[model samples]
Target: MVLSFLALSACSRDFLDITPDGRTTLEEIFQDEKRTEAYLNRVYGSMPSYFWKYGFFDFLAPFSDEAYAYSGAALGWAAGMLTPTINPLHTPQERGKGVYHWGTFWAGIRDANVFLANVETANIPSPTNRERFRGEARLLRAFYFWELIKEYGPMPIVTEPFANDYDYTTLTRPTFEECVNFIASECDIVIGNSNLPMRITTEAERGRFTRAVAYAIKSQALLYNASPLWNPGNDKGRWTRAAEAAKQGVDALTAQGYALVGDYSNYFLSKTDISSAPGDRETIYEVHEPQIDPVFSIINSIPSKPGMFKVGATPTQELVDSYEMQATGEPVILGYQDEEHTQPIYNPASGYDPANPYVGRDPRFYATVWYNGAAYDNIGGEIHLMETYVGGADQLLVAPLGWAFTRTGYYLRKFIDPKLQSGQPEDTRWKKYRLAELYLNLAEAENEANGPTGLAYSAINTVRSRVHMPDLPQNLTQEQFRQRVRNERRVELAFEEQRFWDVRRWKILDQTDKLVTGMEITKEADHSFSYKRFVTEYRALWADKNLLMPIPLTDASIIPDFDLHQNPGY
Candidate 1:
């Protein structure tokens, strides 16, 4: 993998560094359709390869409602990290930037560009294959832009393959508008194409691109633009474009066979079971792999109760508390009885449960966060354990370790099947886009366009209904409705790799805390240290200029032009 990455990076130093060295010219490469499809397959795989490390700072990993984080782990690191929740920092795991994995994205982008340049002339025998190639390129291109917009803001929008003499190295970044408009327009073309599937008809063709993926991507981009975090630099047009694009994507995907999976949790669990149903009527778009083929895979997220990355919860506690209780339809915070605990108040009048932490919580929490006592059913049977890190020096104070981070206080169980352990690593693919996100996106777009329209309410209600949460107050405003949708997105999309970007675009980092400084009691009322029973408290832990990295201070010192022009606070 390291050699493969290095070889790819040797092609281009810009954006992602994964450019594989192929002696064939662009024209020569695309002449054969099979090669073209194989190249595009790598493009989809790149999303996961990039996303795996991306869980740290790729603008999607840390965007939860709980807390924010900081580190050079990624370019958009500051904006997404450092929110209100789990505030862990200065660990050995903080190299940031999802830096090394970027080679895969850039390499894949290079392939897309090289393949796209020759796509017009491809003599592929089937007309369907031809259109599919075009759609794949368009979708992958959109996917690349997804990274660009989140990381570099409005990066130079590159569509056509560039020449060696294009003088690409000296250019400054593109205007955010220019970049966004280009992405939005391309999605329009991709979404308009009719050759893709909303639901696959064959076993081998499961993870390919579809019209729904296009629409889902467009909605995501549009929502980012519409967000106040990116907007209010007078971005009305961006918001309108986002609304329109999302509407188009939604209308088109919904028209072609997308619907909701009745039990949102079942999608992940059932796929690992052969007896499980094959379709989620609600899935507008998704990326899947059943057998872990190298072409396109998501095995990184499929570890056991104790995973490889003994890292603790990547999810901030703030995100954990955002899910509304099914009965009350309100924020659910798991409080600590300790005086050091910072969870507002735990009284019924304060609106939360102190003893029954997991009861009546956000459905996604149970679905995503494997609490200390959460029981998960896998391929063979049930495994009762906590999703935390209880290894290393201070393992005494922590929970058990898992593949990624140790389950900080809670392990991420969302995409992982309760029945599928790392032992079996069940074939349930690390799913990308499903129907729930589409509904959330629609609610968001509608709320942005007209606040609390019936459309927005219905969209949000559909999602809440699945988990048994009641409808919102009838008189909510647009902003209020938008907040509801935003909160919904936070809980629903937790750990699925959308949080980081969501928080960045929402620009809520500065307004929230970025650490999980909860207090756990070691001493009881009798002044005896509680052995297995300790009290844990929650609060912001640190305040540092490090919130925004110094542009890889070392990189800036070497590159004169970058200078001390740091991001806002760093």
Candidate 2:
């Protein structure tokens, strides 16, 4: 009989461990230094690589208003068809049935527990290495819990592994605040460990956890704790905690010589292989996956051409309108006049013309989205422009009428390496946490804690200046600053999986997720284009119940006696 107490790490990359032959017992595995290192790598593997094929192909973009995936789980999610069994956010193990297996995050946590319990017995000679290993395990454990909390809210805080004879039916989840505090404490333990470096500077140690990562985790948790969905009472203390933690996180990172990248557009295309040179210091933590055939970019790069696959994720006009006009540095659209998003509340002073919408937009807009009439490439010294107008090469096609064309009249260009051609293997690694997020976190928390102070203005302006966008007006009120910060996050972190949680945490999904919009362009008689905003998709009903995902039914069924305490409205 195969008696598996914990699932071993399956990731066999250079950093992760490949279980050697003839290692049958836990005693034997931990007795050797090489085996011990391999075990720790298994803990690292527990982190679901969003860059890897399983998570990347169907990312969280479609689950939120950032973009719409024409097929797969995101499409169903957009239509409000989500349930306990059909949740795209939960059960991300794309390779298997949507079971919330302990083998994924729970398995990682279990492995970390095993490592922490047995690392002292390992055959390591270096004291520093042992402490660092312990720190890494603790940090990974904290991170796994954070992931669970973000998706499903409160969860059972199982720090140590359960015994074979342990009663599974007695498991109970802690309160949301308790879970947040527990994660913060775990991160604090790791942050206090000096053995672990602040930055993983070597290429070989590129994806390893560091103090900065722990800090990022803490900041994220605190910010979520203070958000409206969780802190419905408008708890000032929660805001204060979030503000202090974010500020501390920023200070700790900057002290370690980290800052935003010089160029905003080029940051996504920067190297993931950590070089000793001071290049792209913004990425505090990143994840990398081995390159595979028919790279991810092929799906997101462009619509179906002779060699290209259909654009899997298409940008929505709702997202495009978030960009401020460069000429006036003001938002083009204030809000939608209707829930369907067909009628937009245009800000007239911003000089935004519906017919000439593409011009004079935010610089980051050009980097993130491919719209009609925009210059895409220089082929043989001739500028190649995108023709998204009717009958054009990249024409819009409604669902059920087309497969590989843009449903929303735009293609995602945020992470696409413009330098790489079709079929070329591109770098698939993405920054999990970066300096810009930290700055934004600080700005948000500070604004909540102390109104719109100069510090808050400076924190957000730093991010704006990177893209050459004008700083927000100095005299705006607290609510005005708050809106600016949220928009800044939406555009700056577009397609980065931030908006999905932002809408939930801020409790604005009902307003933002009701429907996504798209622009339809038609070539007029004079060869000019006329633009019209149309509803791309109407999302399912987002309510207070949607503030948290339901615990997977499979897991709940396995322990029938246990309450499982499903989130309401599931």
Indicate which candidate wins on TM-score. Answer: 2
lDDT (Cα, tens digit) per residue for candidate 1, span 61-179: 54333432232432133334432221122212321322433244455576677667777787577777778777877878877776645553554566676676676445455555566
Each prediction's TM-score versus the true structure? 0.74, 0.91
Q: Evaluate all candidate structures by whole-model CA lDDT and list the values in order.
A: 0.53, 0.76
Task: Work out candidate 2's RMSD over C-alphas.
Answer: 4.3
On the 0 to 100 scale, the lDDT of residue 298 in model 2 is 39
- Candidate 2 residue lDDT tens string, 267-298: 77655546655677888888644434444443
* Stretches > 4 Å off in candidate 1: 1-23, 42-45, 50-103, 169-172, 234-237, 270-278, 288-316, 332-351, 376-408, 420-424, 519-570
Model 1 TM-score (2 dp): 0.74
Q: Model 2: which ten-residue window has the lowest total lDDT?
A: 1-10
Pick by lDDT: which candidate is best? 2
